[model samples]
Target: MVKWSISILLIMLLNLAVTSLGNVPNFDYHAFYFIHQWLPSYCNQKGTKCCYPPTGRPAADFTIYGLWPYNDGGNSLQNCPGSSYDVAPLKAIQNMLQKDWPSLTCPQIGRKFWLHEWNKHGTCSKSVLDELAYFHAASNMKNKLNIFEALSKARIIPNNQFYQVENIKAAITQATGYRPFIFCNHDAEGNSQIWQVIFCVDKSGTKLVNCSGSPQGQCAYSTVKFPSY
Candidate 1:
């Protein structure tokens, strides 16, 4: 009788394991945001100098904020239950994060920020199922996109001058073949600045795709600043 009960329990556990593996990959989530942040505006808004490595200031460029997973209807999820992240795998890619994805906040060069992001958003992305893949994919995507080069090729240099929102959008759209959604912030001078550029990508984390619904850019001004370092 005990053997029969144990057999039944084993079957149930196997069924559950299969359900989870199928469900996570097949979940109908829509898109990803290659969330690139403009560090100058972020630091200016925070009223602090952007943190850097001992070598000196990291490039005054768009560093990775995150690669967030978004749903079709505009809602998103966070920190999937039982999802945990470890800092060990990240050590292999530590140099890349330090240069391309450095923490711009002060006092210490830390992993807490990355941990927070993974807990908040990375945990929710089925495409990047584990810690190693999660950070590796983000680092790889940063190199793939290279926001600075894309803008530079379009003759859009970050000299703190105001550029028309449409032109900015066009530059990215032309370069990437996907219309990117822009987010803006006002500097201390109350002029609008381009703060972040968000791109929609596929579940595999490789290609740029159309966003089902773009996040609205908050810059009310016709022209927005892309500040210099």
Candidate 2:
């Protein structure tokens, strides 16, 4: 009778363990969020001193923050199962990365940044399974969007001037056909400043689309500053 009781207890524990495992969040993703970060705001927000790239200063325009994978409802997924980052796949666009996606902090650490991005975010993407595909899709989208030109056409220069959030959104929507989620942080003076612009793309990574889940982050003021690099 004691043996039977012990067996039943083990079985119950095993079932509970399996049930808990099943309740853990899934890693599979349904969409992508192409996040672009402005260099100055990023460096300024960190509080720690930022190291400049040996090559030169990163371009003042939007550089990639990351390409994140999200569920249909826009919940983000990270470090999915069976995901590994290999820079070998990215040789095809290494030059483009240097030009457009150069790490603003210690350019030599670009590899580390890419690796972290892959393990943390890119791995969750189904559409972009490997490093090459992941980066290619992100770079291609940046080229296609030409966000700087869109803002330029609207005369929204990043000269530390404040611009209306609506106008900024309108300019981007007119350029990409989909509205983007703008994220910002406060400067030393507590002035709200632009930090990142994120866009949702389809699973195929072919077209820009509206985010199914509402975008996160809200500006404290109607107008926000865009600090120059």
Which model scores highest in lDDT?
Answer: 2
lDDT of 2 by residue, 57-133 (tens): 66667887788888877788887766587878777777787666767664435777888888888877744567687
Misplaced by over 4 Å in model 2 are 1-14, 106-108, 126-128
Give the TM-score (vs. native) of candidate 2: 0.88
lDDT of 1 by residue, 1-229 (tens): 9999999999999999998987773334576788888888887774566676665778766888887877777555566655676898888887788887777677545587788888887877754557677777787878887778888888888898888988888887777777877888878777789988888777777778877776655456678888898
For residue 189, give model 2's deviation from the true position in Å.
Answer: 2.5
lDDT of 1 at 212: 79
List per-prediction Cα lDDT, in the order shown.
0.77, 0.80
Q: After superposition, how far is residue 33 of candidate 2 from its true place, in Å?
A: 1.2
- Per-candidate TM equals 0.81, 0.88
List of clashing residue pairs for candidate 1: none
